[model samples]
Target: MLIDTYGRVATDLRVSLTDRCNLRCTYCMPEEGLSWLAKPDLLTDEEIVRLVRVAVTALGVTEVRFTGGEPLLRPGLVGIVQECAALEPRPQLSLTTNGIGLGRTAAALKEAGLDRVNVSLDTLRPEVFKTLTRRDRHQDVLAGLAAAHEAGLTPVKVNSVLMPGHNADEAPDLLAWAVAHDYELRFIEQMPLDAQHGWKREGMITAGDILASLRTRFTLTEEAGERGSAPAERWLVDGGPHRVGVIGSVTRPFCAACDRTRLTADGQIRTCLFASEETDLRAALRSGAPDEELARIWRQAMWGKKAGSGLDDPSFLQPQRPMSAIGG
Candidate 1:
């Protein structure tokens, strides 16, 4: 079941369709985006499906999520989703997106077998959104979220990064807006994945800081449930119905139970989001490798996964690629 050296079973696979994004988020990538992979270098839709099939049938993968600098940027995304759905014992499928382009493509994506989506929306204010992402597409994100909900993409999730001076004050307001909109909200403590190499701990907001502010308005009861491989720690808000999540990657680590792996658009396998290196599978894929061989490469990679993501290590180094390039 693709168990790692530390007995962590790998069931969730995040595949990057492309490293090209529309917006340049401050916490994700540099204002001037990095050089993107050429068309030939990016894995084809057929290659992606073949790998998913191997992960599902051979390596015991049960959930597959398509990510990207922006997955919707890929023209073949729906087709890829369709092929993955056609797999026997089809895995749970989902996507992570910036939500700018989702307004026009939400229904098409749902029809193509995408189960749900997690949209990145940092702020409700248009000016703040522009300042954070270097793009004035806040309206587009709002419209896309509405379209996703309208398309029956149940429990549409909104992911916000907690940067202190930037959008920290909006924490309570964001939660209230999410509750009113009936969308799940997640506050992700900013990790060391930015392209600027300026992720100082002092400038970031912790999960405790957010919850403490939230406590002033509503009662948050931690949900004593199985977190499994999911990154976010869930909570029941005020009462039963509405809930909120906080991904305390920095302050409260959940590395021991990490059950996820990532594949870059160019086909490199990353066991952790903050990994220093990645195993290149694109070379083998282009060399006419078979399914079993690909499976072996994946297994070899997972077998070497460290006990944790190593964020706490004094020698911990940031990944060469930015968070956007590495996928969600």
Candidate 2:
């Protein structure tokens, strides 16, 4: 088992399949998406599987999450899922999607052994959705959620980024809807990943503020016995199986319990979400380096893991890359 210098186990890995996304959400991508990684530069399906194998078998990784600019957009996503499912001690396999193309791909994903899904949705109102995403596919996302439920992906998780003045007012309504549908709802604090794209500290909404607002509407009971590397502070609403989670990566960072590492679409290993430097694993992998040498490289990289992201530190400079590039 590989443990970083900070004492966090390397148990979960988020692999970004591509840097390209269909929607240009203000927080994630620029109005015009940045120049994308060249086709040959992105890790192929086979390379992704090999990396997953290394992470799980050698590094004690127990959970594998496929992320993206929208993982479903990748052509060989189902095949990749199939390969991940065949691992010896099969890790808990999941995917995070924008739910745009899920209507056509959810069934195939489930058939290929995906265990769960988390969909990114901010508002229930169509116009607000369009204003937020710059796309008029609100109905399509709703349809995709329904399709996922029909395909037996029960209690699908919905991820909502709470942005002040934009969708913060919708928290109560969103939680109520989640309770009705028996889906887990998570409220994420907006981070400063793309500061140039209008991410200001003043424009941010904290997790505490969100919880306080929700408490006014429903009596929230803290969930006990929650486990693993989950960053969310889980709570249960009165008389519902619906769990409300707050991912306070910004206002209340979870750098202490961060057990996850990320692999960019091009095979760079990022130890932290806010990390500016990345270890070039693709170059080493493609160069026919021996397994022991690759393991040594991984070890060296993990040793250099920073103590914390220090997001609130005034000295912190926003990463030059966008969230899409880093697989947030």
Computed on alpha carbons, the lDDT of every model, listed in order, comes to 0.89, 0.85
User: Total clashing residue pairs per candidate?
Assistant: 0, 0
Q: lDDT per residue, candidate 1, 201-301, as tens digits?
A: 76679889999988888889988878876788888988858889999998889989988988999889999998887899989988999989999999999
**Root-mean-square deviation of every model:** 1.1, 1.4
Q: What C-alpha lDDT, on a 0 to 100 scale, does residue 105 get in candidate 1?
A: 96
Cα-lDDT of candidate 1: 0.89
**Highest lDDT scorer:** 1
TM-score of 1: 0.98
265 Cα displacement, candidate 1 (Å): 0.2
What's the C-alpha lDDT at position 34 in model 1?
Answer: 79
lDDT of 2 at 227: 46
Write model 2 residue lDDT over 1-328, tens digit each, in one string.
6578778777889999998888878787777737998999999898899988888887788999999888888999999999999998999899888998889988988999999889999999999889888899999888888778878776699999876667878889999998887778999988877635567777678898899989989989888884456889889898546689999887877777788888999999888888889999899889998666666777678778888887888878787767887886
